[model samples]
Target: MVQNPERRTVLADAAIEVLARDGARGLTFRAVDREAGVPAGTASNYFANRNALLTQAAERIHVRLRPDDATIAAMARSRPAPSPEVLERELTAMYHRLAVQQIDYLALLELRLEAIRRPEIRAALTATMRANLEQNVAAHRESGLPGSDVDVVLMYLALSWLIIENLTLPGVLEGYDADRLIAALTDLVAGR
Candidate 1:
């Protein structure tokens, strides 16, 4: 069957919504169709099976949730060769934005959890995540951010964990200033 890219994208987007709201277990062809407000069997036509749908949803979440070019450009422009202070500021802003989009992050977390039991899904997610990390490393290099590839990877992991924790458990770390924390992290990652 000839694939319709637009229709596939729409279905995948709807699947992401369902995954975010209802989780992996709740994600079914019917649920996606209903979420998409499409007729029954529409999701089935686009995805061959549950795994395909899940994989597509994971891919869509990454695509839809990634920061736009403007934001990236702004970050790059924040500093010619970002010092620890500048890196901390950029990371703080990024974390705040992620907190604001908590649901999308939560959906990604759900995908990760689902992948734990499914090797194929795990492999797909791992590949996507590695590609994302490589892209981050490249961006850091191109933008002259302070850090080696390993440092960049470490920074990404730390920031992601901190963002997840902060979003999931609001006010849990109230005594500590996030900016200060990020500054310390930036210093550590940059080996300053």
Candidate 2:
């Protein structure tokens, strides 16, 4: 409802930080406003309700987590042909990049938990996640990257769980190098 797109985006991002740090129950207009360093009523004016705030937060997470096109293109060129080594490098690079955004990824995980009971959140996440997945699969396929569509799907599941495990329960994979783990996936999919 807020006409200032930049301010609204700022509030939504603040809501993400609040949600991740404070959990669903702690996500309030005041919290978001405080996080954004805006006026106390700023978030309330920007969002229609808590649900709207939640949905916008989800959307904002999608935007924040997206890799820029230049990065994608560089990755595409990193491995000009389909091979196990190519797949390994690509996956390893992707994992490294995502690992750097620890906070944003954790925020996404929090949003997933909140989505369970909120239909609006579930719907928004589903739509954007589906689109993102499809786009990724297409990119992988078109880039002549290693792995079949089925492999892409499987790796997607594995990588997502890997991220979750690394973020939420780091000790579970203690002593194991994340890049090597991703390389194992490349092996399985690329027929090495």
Candidate 3:
């Protein structure tokens, strides 16, 4: 197979814009075509269908946010390494960023919602999310904590989702202060 960087770039960019504006339900071949200014047929040619497009778009997002191996190594070397306290703080920030950042969070939500109905998309999302979790687990492990344990990794994952869930829960915005949440998480991670 030949690589057409420009075409792939166009498709990927178009996919993100479409997802951002329309969510999963609004993403379709023709919609992307219009958004990307490409022929409908051409957009379809590249993506084959909506699922393929979403999977690629989600992967793109993952790639953009995931720390490169070299960066991870540098972090391992220079950083004081995370204690449970630091881990909690870092995760809380990540949760806040994802929830408050409209485009990124919305796109991720779209991928997740669609993944429920599409097995292929679901698998792709699971794999991508797993990779992200593993990276975090590795960092935690390197920090001289008990992070390498399956239990620690599982706990972090559960806590991360709780952050997301609480943000979306009813009355959370009215009752919860974001800064307080972050501070509380810091203490929680410290095992206070």
Candidate 4:
């Protein structure tokens, strides 16, 4: 069947919402359809089965979570030559914005965990994450951020863990302020 990109996107977004609220086992065409407020079987029309829905939902989460080009451009314009401090500020701001969207991140975490039980989903998610990492590295380079690709990769891993922990278990790092933590991360990435 011919796919409707717009409808598929809508269904996938609904699937993410379901996955976030109900985890992988709870995701179903009916649940997605309900979440989307579409008629019954609408999600099925877009996705062949649960796995396809899961994969599409994972892709949608990645797309929805990334910073837009305009935001990136504004950040790039903020500093002609991005210094360590500038990079730190930008990274902190970006992560803070992400922190506010806790549900989306929670859904992503759910998807990652779900992938562990499904090898096919795991492989697809790994590829998607690798692509995202590469794209982030290229964006950092283009914006003149102070980091090599390897540095960016490491920073990405650290930031991902930090964000996940901060969102999932608030006050776990009670002694450290967000800015101070981000500063340390910035210094680490900058090799200071």
Expressed as tens digits, the lDDT of each residue in 29-64 for candidate 2 is: 999999999989999888889999999988888788
| TM-score between candidate 1 and the true structure | 0.89
lDDT of 4 by residue, 1-192 (tens): 438888899898998899889988889899999999999988887777788888887777878888888986776666656789778988788778888887798889988998989876787788888899989899888878798888888778877877888988878977878778889989988877
What tens-digit string does per-residue lDDT give for candidate 3 at 41-125?
A: 7777776667778887877777655556796676457655556655665556556655554565557777888888998888888
Give the TM-score (vs. native) of candidate 2: 0.94
Candidate order by TM-score, decreasing, is: 2, 4, 1, 3
Write down the worst ten-residue block by lDDT for model 3: 145-154
Q: Which candidate's TM-score is highest?
A: 2
User: Per-residue lDDT for 97 in model 3?
Assistant: 52
Q: What is the lDDT of candidate 2?
A: 0.85
> What are the root-mean-square deviations of the candidates from the true structure over C-alphas?
1.9, 1.4, 3.5, 1.5
- Per-residue CA lDDT of model 1 for 15-67, tens digit only, reads 87888788888999999899889899999988889998888777777677689
Two-way lDDT contest, 3 vs 4, winner: 4
